[model samples]
Target chain A: MTALTSAVTAPGVLGRSRALVRPALKEAVGRMHPWVGEMAAYSFGWCEVGGGPAVASGGKGVRQALAVLGAEAAGAPGRAGVPAAVAVELVHTFSLLHDDIMDGDAARRRRPTVWKAYGTGPAVLAGDGLFALAVETLAGTSAGPAALRLLSASLGDLVRGQADDLLFATRPWAGARRVRPGEYLAMAEHKTGALLGCSAALGAVLGGAPPAVVTGLDRAGRHLGVAFQIVDDVLGIWGDPEVTGKPVHGDLREGKKTYPVLAALDAPSPATAHLVTVLESAGDPAVAAALIDEAGGRTAALAEARRHVAAAEAALAGLPIPAGAADDLRSLLDFLVCRDL
Target chain B: MTALTSAVTAPGVLGRSRALVRPALKEAVGRMHPWVGEMAAYSFGWCEVGGGPAVASGGKGVRQALAVLGAEAAGAPGRAGVPAAVAVELVHTFSLLHDDIMDGDAARRRRPTVWKAYGTGPAVLAGDGLFALAVETLAGTSAGPAALRLLSASLGDLVRGQADDLLFATRPWAGARRVRPGEYLAMAEHKTGALLGCSAALGAVLGGAPPAVVTGLDRAGRHLGVAFQIVDDVLGIWGDPEVTGKPVHGDLREGKKTYPVLAALDAPSPATAHLVTVLESAGDPAVAAALIDEAGGRTAALAEARRHVAAAEAALAGLPIPAGAADDLRSLLDFLVCRDL
Candidate 1:
């Protein structure tokens, strides 16, 4: 294997892709109206809340990296994937802005979210502006029509996922049956996997790849996305606050119906009953975590994530891509499912 | 002049166009996910909030009419413009859904707004779904790219306008200078005119019109849009509630910074001072309306609306459309400016 094919951490791949994608992403955001642009910049961690100087704190550019890898796997230059990369990143950021408002999340990446710092009205408008800008940016690319269609369809899926999430979160837990694992996985596929699948498919289409290659990348990305969300559920319960830049057990505190919590509730054990009791009241995070662990929820979730990672890797095996590209994808899959934070 | 060249009432033209466009618009909205489709259908007054039977209560379909007229003027069948018409109407409904949420509006068209009936999260997702579906629908059209670019750019303008409206509404009235009429007009242009211009441009482009014809139609649509907004402002203050389906002096009751309100503030009259004082506190709608009328705000706004209508009509004069098409446009322009509701 080449040096580029060697196992690399998630942050390492993110850093390399961020170096290439951030400039174009920034430029695309800069095209928004001045006030909207400022809010978007703040949301992206490119600047402070009041807009003084750059902060450079942002989420890992996993989607953009996937775009670049997908394009390269299709034998196109990474630079040729810049527009699709930027488009996906913008859509991701747009969802974050609106989701923060809808979820009533006050902070992200250890800083006050846009809605918390500015106001809900401005945050909503800024999100809408980013969405429009995403379409506008893709419309200027050589594969404009195809990319627009993919992005638009992905957006619909994202909205549907969000709607389902909201409905599931508000269900009457006292009398309601435990949400099935299949239902949770389906929602995750829509909420998290759809955009990732679009990211890969868009890059491949823009790179002039064959339909088979696009379909393969999309399936691989979807599996990887599900695995990523499962890992996120794990981290939400037990992650180190310092490393995650989020409060430990934050999702538990918010009473979120994440994968691990759902799994624990669905488990046929006395510990599951205790976990449910704790979740229904103001139980301490440590006790709840212990109950969930004793019920085998943590192990079950981790195992499911591994299964998805394996499936993702299998999906890429038949694709006519370079060995190095496949190796990088496998590394990403591993990093995603195994990350500590 | 032929019979088609004769002046027509606003309802006459609206009724005709609504018959032509509503079927296509309904089908397009019906293509969304079932839940989202239900919310959209409710918002459009096509069904009840939880979805049982159809109850069609909707806007006048003015933008869709303008789109179809634009294409027909460019010598294409009106049916050929259905996709663009549906696209523009979906975008308009999307704005209404989100704007109603941002503005905390409880009711629209004498019924509960989407956010009020179905909850804010579902309303937002439904709006987003409609937006994505708009782009998806347009992507299937022959004029997909150009139409997409126009709609995307118009959406950015609309968001900017909404942002400014929120900023203006939140400004402290104690020491701040009065908002100028120019600023209000500019905001209205962004809020209303951009999409109308895009509708005309997209239709003309779709119909294979020359560049100059498209430009002419865009300019005309913009002017007509401004006039439409001005009339809406007038209706907000003094129109009969039975006709407008809103409370009399609704804008005054809500302290909206509309065209007439801004003009009243700028007028050099003792009523202007008193109106500002009343606006700063809990003012009676009847007194506020009287003060605005006495200050000549109503007259000034009416004059401005007429000027825009004249400009809109003049723009059509130089276009290479059939006389009947030009007459229809002029009739629509006149109807828009002179409407009672």
Candidate 2:
């Protein structure tokens, strides 16, 4: 790793990415009907619930950062990845807006979710608008076709993941219908990994990278996504409310089929039986949380997350890119996986 | 018009389009999660609300037929246009699925709407799935990038049109906020015409036509869409329930800002004031409908429809296609504008 790569922190890479992507995204949003635009602005954390300016800005730009980094790794300037950055970010926002409505979530990032802030219809349309822009953003560019194929396939995986998650809600906690551990992992990979994979691939492709390099970056991002999702799942179950800005044991209370719960349920420990009973009977969420911990769910989940991260790291090692960019990429992935709630 | 053109009836053109597009459409839907696939099947009229195979096999396939014909007009075989046909049809289905949920509509094509049959969340996913497939269908083909760009822009127009329609619901029947006549027509063009325009353009592009011919065909479709929309507006108000499969005066009852009502409100006749009073006071829908008619709203709307149809015919006359295809195109447009509810 070069001194410049060491000096360039994760936040710096992310800031640079946002600098390039935000303007294009803003222009796209500005072109929408004023009503839908308001909802989209609110979803992006740029406005208050009732439509005034907000200071919070938006997401951490993880996908956008990855896109920029992927470009840099391909020996192109980060600006070369702006279209992919904008597109992936747009898709991420679209998914978040719709998911909030589908999951009946009221709050996110310590603020009201888009559906809760606006009406469900408006939120849905806003999400659709963002999606439309995402596709247009790619198709309007010279490098659009390949990236669009990646995006289209990712959408299928996303819907499949969401569908499986919704279906899991109806399955019994302690019967043959109970979701399996491998099923939970597959869902996580599909729901979260696919977009991350696409973002990396799209960026490299946009940066004029060859197909082999794009495929390698895609694999790295996918593994990293699974690791990141596991961290999120853990936070949902046991993170500090003040830090996560979320209620404690939310996954348990909502009966979410998360990684930790599935891992514990698959454990050979006797505590697994008690965990199922608590979940099935709709008992105290805290009790279920404790039983899951006692059954080694926490350690198992963390271990699984580490394994994926290792896989991501291995994928990154073979990439023929600037060694400095590769180091920065590893550091960024590490930060994502090891972040606090 | 050539003899072959005269012999090719609207139904024949539509039937051939369906025969080519349906199998492709079926295969795409089959790729989704089974739960979402069921809802999509229901939306396409391939299945009942509860999931059994149904007698009703879907929409009129007018967009698909236009796509096929557009390709033929570009001097290519109709089969070359199947990708565009499928893509446009997919986008149409996507709009309908989301629109049903947004509009709170209960029935379409004499069956329960997707959201009404399944839950809103499931229907939303199903719409998104169709949208995903639409993009993929384009991107997977050689003619993808340009067609995808057209589709993306059309989505923006479609959303803008819908947003305007939704916003109009909050406007007063008799005040400064009353929807303007020009605004309503623009909204109608956006909501009803954009995808139609895209369908024609996409087909010609897929058939290897140059950009100028694509633009001309797009304009023709746009005019036809406005004419088709006006006819639909009239049917909503006055068409027999048995034929239309809709409640009588549904637009008035639902306070829809349709072309006829906007025309009536804009008229110089004294009866316009009475119509406004009836609408604002929430008086009987039938009374409002009759007053709107008495003010010549129906005549005005039909006249507007005829003008658009004429515009469409004029645009088609300049096309560089085989004369037979042009004649067939005009005949199809005529059938769409002239059909009974």
Candidate 3:
């Protein structure tokens, strides 16, 4: 482990970042057209459907925290990162809206997805609106042009990653070409890491950090994002539905080729073969999980997640970030990847 | 009619604009990731499915022409407008992609729509990618910040317009909440006019035009867009399928609440009442068309189109546009509003 990872995780960092970002996000989204603003509010859990009062519960705001921590690491005020934080959250929400439609996901956060609550058309428009608003918000900042470019390029990577995910899902595993583990990692990086990296880089830029420091923060973000996704893949099968706000073995039941399942498939053992057979047959989730566990899939996934976390710390080690801010980021990384859900 | 309108429409002006904008659009889209780039190419009718070679016939490039004309009006070379032109066309294409999915349109330009051919998921992503690419392309220009702001605000208006349209379509029309003619026009202004206005404004800004000139050009573009939509409503019910690349009475059959139909419904005549009844019952397209025509809906729509065109001309008249550029714009406006399809 790097020196950064060895430091104690900072308490209250996540909550403090949320405190800074939430109001800013609300203001930016409020500036949208009424109808879209309402939809966005609902999507963000700011208000109940049909413009009722705020409900308050929302996502973990990990990206927003990262943005704040990144800015602080460069010795800028936490408020200096608000625009980047809001922008990143908006992008994340936009992706969720579209992804729910594309994946036919019915629930998110234990509630009906936007596409389910609102029609597909409105949901699509709302997502588009959020994306435009994100760019608009960033463009209004002092770092407008640079931030816009970074976010736009990150969006491109996101779409490509989603396209690859869909393509891989549809392609047969027995085909002449199957998605390799490396390709999956690349897709994860593009899909999840790109935006996180952008978020950090944007904060660093907003803080007026030097190029090398910005690049280092970006790399750190990418590593954390990869680790986050790998941990998510593990949770998809083993996580408590009450905690995760998702069904147990959700990914396995859907035959999702997530890291653990893919790793199990790559393993050369009878249990691995059995796991593949169970998956192909749409067997029970418990049986599939047991088979995967017997094949050491869970262990391998956990190891991979740890490896990424270590890499994330290593990326931060050489950076010129202040010690306190680095500890905050390390805390964030730990909270993200080491969560039970 | 202006002296320019009295003359024959410039024989190759549209063709010339297409030639300039198409290559620039292709190059910009080429800069996108291969997946989205291929999808964009296919959507633009530049290629067939599965990454085939270029096939070519695409949109009318009206917005591209307007961009170039706006630039020339500001005394810049037509090529100075290429980036703005490409950006507008990308925005237009992005709208088409989403609109097709929302409207369940199976074909466009006599070929399968992107959503129909490529599935809803990829189509949505492709639209998103195009939007990002549009802003990205604009951001690369010297007028990047201003252009980005214009396009982003225009996008917000576009989403609001789409939302209003969907809301109007779903709402009952017999009560105090019936969609007013003014509201429909406003929606059209938001949905169609905003981007066209941005396109012109962008061109003017790119050409280093004065602020007043930019605003005037934007107003002219908005009027032109309104006129174009009104003309399209007239043709939707009356134009030959062979000419419009749509089924005869296409809008009527689909029960689209276009300008003409709304005008007919608002008319104080038995024919108007009968048209409403027919529409409510999903009556035959021929019957609905006959009722609308008898109620003078066609005439009213034509008048509205002409009024908007005149307003557009008046907006142009006050600007310091060179006489030749003014004439070109007037001729283009006439072509747009007077065309059969």
Specify the highest-DockQ model's number: 2
* The best candidate in terms of TM-score: 2
Better structure of 1 and 2 per DockQ: 2
Q: What are the per-residue Cα lDDT tens digits for candidate 1 across A155-184?
A: 888887887787777664334665677878
- DockQ for every model comes to 0.59, 0.75, 0.63
Point out where model 2 deviates above 4 Å. A1-8, A339-341, B1-8, B339-341
Query: lDDT of model 1 at residue A233?
Result: 88
lDDT of each: 0.81, 0.85, 0.82
lDDT measured at residue B202 in model 1 versus the true structure, 0 to 100: 77
lDDT of 2 by residue, A113-178 (tens): 887877888888988898998898889889967888988999888888888888888888777878
Docking class of 1: medium
List pairs with backbone clashes in candidate 1.
Answer: none
lDDT, residue A339, model 3: 53
Error of 3 at A21 (Å): 2.7
- Candidate 3 CAPRI level: medium
lDDT of 2 by residue, B139-199 (tens): 9889857888888999889989888888889899877778987898898889988888888
Ranking by lDDT: 2, 3, 1
Clashing pairs in 2: none
Q: Which CAPRI tier for candidate 2?
A: medium
* Best-to-worst ranking by TM-score: 2, 3, 1
